[model samples]
Target: METSKVIVEHIFLLVIVTLFSVLQNAFFAVKLEREGKGGNATAFERVSCAVRNCMDAYPTFLAVMWCAGLCVSQGPAAFAGILYLVVRQKYFVGYMGQTSQSTPGFMFGKRPIFFLILMCMVGILNYLLGHFYGRCYKAQLETLTSVVAALLLIP
Candidate 1:
């Protein structure tokens, strides 16, 4: 497949993941109101924490997703992205039930993200080594960097 096609496919997957994240937040908000907890700041605290955690992780997730898709392996990258969405959903739901029950979900979500980060770091190091070894890594690195920048710039 062409590089652009691959990138587009990965972007679509990322969008789906993003939509799921939004849905999770919406679910929590509805739950809060339905349970008469909307007025309870403490009741909203867990949901808020979950939403904030997602927000904090999102940018890194995008960067790693793109880097892995372009430089590492698109299939694995996409799988990891989907896995993140699944585990994150699990985390959100588990946290809604009980804070203690969220630990497994948190670990599941975190491990895939950690792996993706490792993949991104390895991909970058490989590109750097190729550059040092006189290969044409600069163009690829620039392309990846540009894509990441564009993604980050998106609201």
Candidate 2:
């Protein structure tokens, strides 16, 4: 598939995921209110914080996803985006339950973002190297770059 098509599909998926997160947060708030826990300001605070965290990270995530999609590979970029959605969902559920339970999901959610950032850095490096050293090194650098990107997924 063409890169633009792939990127658009990824963006669509991101939008759906974002909506789900928002809905999930709203569900928590409604449930808390029904249970009469809403009177406890901390309960509302926790839910709002969770939702706010997602909102805070979203723009940066979108930017990084776009950079990876344009500069690296669409498949990997989309994979990272989907992974973000999954981990963020996990995080929301856990945070709603207990703060301690949220750590694992929060930590895992960061991995894909870090990988995306690394991919962007590598892409810039590759471009610069290709330009300065000529085409002779471009193929080798591309291979090396892919290897490094793949290694980021390892435990």
Candidate 3:
């Protein structure tokens, strides 16, 4: 199992993906901040909405997916689901934190980068653990995830 790239990738997502999403999600909380003179909600309300819209991930889905992948076989799909979610969280955080000039650079650059990395990680990992076993499938996603992850960790 130590040599399983699938395991390694899953662990990476479990730690970095989840941590980044939660922190970014917390930082990402949206708020209206305007009192209801007629039609307005507070920041708390917006945040609560976002929280509700979240992909319902937690100890169960994520853990179960990984467990199923290893223990049963249908786990990778769960893991993929979780991966998609965490990636979405990152997108939400980035979207809510962008500026003007940084729009293209943000959208064309960071957004794509984030999408590619997280997406590839989820896809490749799922494929590996699910069917391929180790046939090698371009691995661009792994490269992106690892590189971006390293960059994010940098000061």
Candidate 1 stretches with Cα past 4 Å from truth are 1-37, 134-155
Query: For each candidate, what TM-score against the reference?
Result: 0.66, 0.68, 0.32
Q: Taking the tens digit of each residue's C-alpha lDDT, what string does model 2 give over 46-147?
A: 766777787789788878876765566555666677777778878877887788888988998898898888767766776777689764444454455456
Higher-lDDT candidate of 1 and 3:
1
- Candidate 1 — number of clashing residue pairs? 0
lDDT string, candidate 3, 14-71, tens digits: 4554465466545544332222233534434544444444434344444543443333
Error of 2 at 51 (Å): 1.0
lDDT of each: 0.67, 0.69, 0.44
Q: Candidate 2: where is the Cα deviation over 4 Å?
A: 1-40, 136-155
What clash count goes with each model?
0, 0, 3
Sliding window of 10 residues with minimal summed lDDT for model 2: 135-144
In candidate 1, position 30 carries an lDDT of 77
Pull out the clashing pairs in model 2: none
